[model samples]
Target: MKATDPSQPRERALLVQVVLGRRDRREAEDSLAELERLADSAGAATIGCITQRRDRPTPGLFVGEGKLVDIQLACREGKANVVIFDNELSAVQVNNLDLALGIKVIDRTEVILQIFARRARSAEAKVQVELAQLQYLISRIPVSRKQQRFQGGIGMRGPGESPLQLRNAPMRRRISDLKRRLDRIGKRHASVRKRRPWPLVSLVGYTNAGKSTLLNACTQAGAYVDDRLFATLDTKTRLVHVPENRKLLLTDTVGFIRHLPHGLVASFRSTLDVARESDLLLLIADAADPGIATQIDVVHETLAEIEAEAVPYMIVLNKSDAATQDQLDHLLAIHHDAVVVSARKGEGLDKLKARIVEELLAHDVHFPGENDHG
Candidate 1:
């Protein structure tokens, strides 16, 4: 058993989604739409999607046994070489699904990790993503010979560093080593922050909420703007000059999602510091998304975990062109201060910019330069 080579040609995938308990059919459909975006970002064409309603997932299979069979059939019909589960599957479940389906089965968490592995640009980001992949692989590596397709490359490569075993002691030591390296990166990040006086503004929200779009609109960043989940996995920073003589360092980091892998959070802590250190958080929400509330909660939960709740924030409801009037009214009713904008069309961006300026000026107590420090 060998770890799948990312450099190999893309594999067609069948996305399987399991809906537990009572959930709105429309909402579930929307979630699958977002999942498709994630799949596309990972260079996979989604040939089929299966949505199964169940009280709870089976212990061995995420979906019911009947639905799992259905999914297997669908994959065969679609000629999909890989099966992607919308929810995170446990180590055992992944193995079971693969055996039963006779094809590669990967969970949402693993898919996201693969995207991060591909999109990671900086050396630091590359190191961090690889470490996360290793951690995930370590957890999923099975003991039985018959139940493991994730045998190699999970914890093998380093970013021009030493290699370690994927299994036991070596993996543990590598994890420790990565943490120490990230600690050093954190110290340097802090030093850079201390030397700068410009206010930092972080764009955060659920995946596919247009954080990258807003970043580009404001700063003319030319950063890749895709209508997909986690399009901007690496944190991108650029200078923006807003109204009222205000200047800020706007940063777009990885987007949040419900049930985001814990290993990713831990591994990407260094990248998350940009958000933690920000003076203002622009919590972008998709105005047309039905699960906006749940998305907001997921972002807040992530912020709490990262200890970034202390930062003042402004809610920016984006994609106004696509939002209905009723949706607009509902959003305003819930968040009165939120500025509505279409990041793609450049609509209402000025108002959003003004509000950000207002927030920054409210905290605009300045000290002299080092030469004139009192």
Candidate 2:
């Protein structure tokens, strides 16, 4: 999806989700909640939501015709100008939904790419995100053109006028150009990494999991932190001084989310390489989230996808101040060695630093941060 144009009116969005088989209703609802956060991050005002239970999505429109009608009604009553789905939609499905609902229709992948595009600041990030967005559009060019971004140009003018190959030529050349640019950026990044002397430690976690906040607390990096999804798209690296004047290179990376678009992951490979090459990974998570376990698993899955799972990691359960004592105790019992800390409140950071020392030095050396001020 294209980034919302600031000059245009704010988009009011109607969210849609489908529950398959006997899947947990709560899980689907939680996913919808996260989608709402994504919509909010994209500067869209979510006005309503629609959910359906089905063994599988209908082939063409995704939802059944009756459900489609219901969605149209919701859009009218809610005054929504857009419909965002929690499910992945085929190009045909997106086109059909757009025509049926008489509004912009984008799926989860589009929404995520839109967020990444909007939040990207650095030149490398901008290239990476633009590449990903183009790659996503490449698959849909033959069918869907309502995204408005592809509304102009050759293949985007509609599929039938020119031969499919001819229509695809311009987009193909543009994609190749973006990839070449990204490759140069990647090589430069690698050269910088090779010259850095300190051992690098990377922070990885679910979106909005306080990774940025923790970076700020630990290194005073003044990294951007927001209570919204994908707030930090570019990695922020800082020199972290542990006790005894020993130094470690720490970085806060783009946070992971469930069902992260494969195109987005491939495009961000250069940025996420910091994780795969790190001396250690701090797999931080929100300790208070009711779905904490699932979120942690999602992070693990993403690390593996990026081939960062081999890097030794220590779990730092953040947001302890917001969790009940029972919740903390239960998590600690399960993730026995995990450190509990509240980045917002500066609590239990000493223990986390001590653990980092042990992990980094390959011995049981302890830091003198036995309290909040590590």
Indicate which candidate wins on TM-score: 2
> Could you give me the TM-score of model 2 versus the true structure?
0.89
Backbone clashes in each candidate structure, one number apiece? 0, 0
Poorest lDDT segment (10 consecutive residues) of candidate 1: 365-374
Could you tell me the lDDT of residue 219 within candidate 1? 83
Error of 1 at 22 (Å): 4.5
Flag regions of model 2 displaced more than 4 Å.
Answer: 1-9, 143-162, 363-374
* Cα lDDT tens digits for candidate 1, 165-263: 333777788888998999899889878977777778899999889999989998889887776667777888898887646567889888898778888
lDDT tens per residue, model 2, 212-253: 999999988999999989999999999888766767788999
Q: lDDT score, residue 195, model 2?
A: 75
